[model samples]
Target: MEWTGARYADKPTVEVRTWVNATPERVWAIVSDVSLMPDMSDELQAVQWVDGDRPAVGGKFVGRSRHESFGEWSTTSHVIEYEPGRTFAWAVADLDRPSAIWRFRLSPKDSGTQLSEWMQMGPGRSGLSYAIDAMPEKEQKIVFVRMREFEQNMATTLAHIKKLAES
Candidate 1:
């Protein structure tokens, strides 16, 4: 069935936040260190630096991501916004549409730094994501049974960051 856009609207796009038990500055030491992602993420297979310095605004990097449910996906991201210990955002592009923005904002609180991770998927990206979400209903459902796995993946990744920051 061809999508009429309702399925795209049903796709859940959300930000996952956690109160990290460390200062924003401390957390930035990890998140802003772009080279470390492959080691921390199970899905990001590799990051090949394209130009400019690591984690700087306007820098570009190409990477590959692999998931059991989605196989391999590739994209190059350009840093859109960067602030020392407060925020950083990037746009991943070159597939079929505008791009998706991944943003992280840090706010200091009494408990620790509040880490909010935001993902804004573009038009076609949302539709494509909904198609993935719809894959489990087919007769042979083995293809993308865990299609929305990024939700859990991001949660776990954020938890890992919390753990690393605390100790």
Candidate 2:
């Protein structure tokens, strides 16, 4: 991802995609299972369903994350979109004005699947907001650094998923 000098209010986003040598159904099975994410992610520590056992548009989940710089924190995410074998998305903190939004999209390509993981941070307040508030002059720099971290992490996640799906 290229630097945009984004600020928290800009709602910066980062996405990473990979072609998996597996069917969309196979990829969907993995992506939709939030329980599997903590293992694939570096910052995410755990995830548990709050309302239901499986993915649903109105369901909720709590995710525990730990960042070396920011420390550990948890967030409740509401599932905003759920389309079997195609898309899965959730909004963190608030349904109407989320602090973050995350998504997974899958599409058939050739004999495999094209899978994408995307996330957008903040039109609403979040932990990062505290950092920005403390260093108001460096808001853009902070946002840029965080966005890059997300980009790298998302790429690692996709690579892990690709390995799992292709195996």
Candidate 3:
């Protein structure tokens, strides 16, 4: 991700994909369980369903994340898209006005499933915006570094999911 001077308006995204030697059902089982996400992520420390027992659209969840540079924070996310064995997506913070959108997609392969994890940064206020506001001159650099961090973390997350699904 080269510098595009991406700001909140740019809504930049980072995605990582991998093929797992498992059925779509198997992969979906792992991805749908938001509670398991922390075990697969670098920044996320925990997640809990807010009021619903299932991953249906409109359901909410709270996630706690710890970042080395940014510190720890929590956010409530609303399930925006939920299709069992195919896709799961959520919007962080306000559903009508999200700070970010995150998704997990699964597709059937010959003997396995292709799984992808993707996330798009905000077009609204978020932790990043606070940092940018404090150091307006280095906005591009800050966004770039954060995007890279997201990329690496997403890749690691995919790898962990693949391992779990295959085993």
Candidate 4:
């Protein structure tokens, strides 16, 4: 993935895709399982269902993430889309004006599944806002760095998911 300086309210984003040698069901099982996320993510340290029994449109979850530069923080996410074996997505904080939107999409491809993970950094105030506010002159630099981190981490996550699902 290469940075193109895509922006939303001055925030950049990263999206990565990978083809996994497994069925959509297999990929969805891992992708939609919030309990399994922390293990697959580099920044996410933990996750838990905040409401409802499992992931569904309208469900909520809390994610705890720690970064070397940003330290640790937790955010609440509200499920905005949920389609078993196809897609799962959530908006972080202030559903009406979210700080971020994250999604996973799965599609059948050559007896396997094509999985893509994407994130859009805010149209509203988020954790990154603090950094931008602190260094207005370096806002673009900060977003670029964070998006790069997200891309690398997303690749790792897709690799781990592919490994597990294929096995």
Whose TM-score is greatest here?
A: 2
Ranking of all candidate structures by their TM-score, best first: 2, 3, 4, 1
What would the per-residue lDDT of candidate 2 be over residues 21-52, giving only the tens digit for each residue?
99999998889989999999999999999856
Q: Write the per-residue lDDT of candidate 3 for residues 38-113, one digit (tens) a residue.
A: 9988899999998665799989999999988789999999999999999999999987779999999999998999
Model 4 residue 105 distance off true place after TM-score fit, in angstroms: 0.4
For model 4, the superposed segments whose C-alpha errors exceed 4 Å read 1-11
Candidate 1 per-residue lDDT over residues 59-151, each given as its tens digit: 888878886646788888888889989998887874335356678889999868999877755544532564556663541232123334555
- Identify the leading candidate in terms of lDDT: 2
lDDT of 4 at 114: 95
Better of 2 and 3 by lDDT: 2
Residue pairs clashing in model 1 are none
Question: Which rank order by lDDT, best down to worst?
Answer: 2, 3, 4, 1
Report residue 163 deviation for candidate 1 (angstroms).
Answer: 1.0
Model 3 root mean square deviation, Cα atoms: 2.0
Question: What lDDT does each candidate get?
Answer: 0.70, 0.92, 0.90, 0.87
Span of 10 residues, lowest total lDDT, candidate 3: 1-10
Worst 10 residues of 4 by lDDT: 1-10
What's the TM-score of each model vs. the native?
0.76, 0.96, 0.95, 0.93
lDDT for 66 in candidate 3 is 93
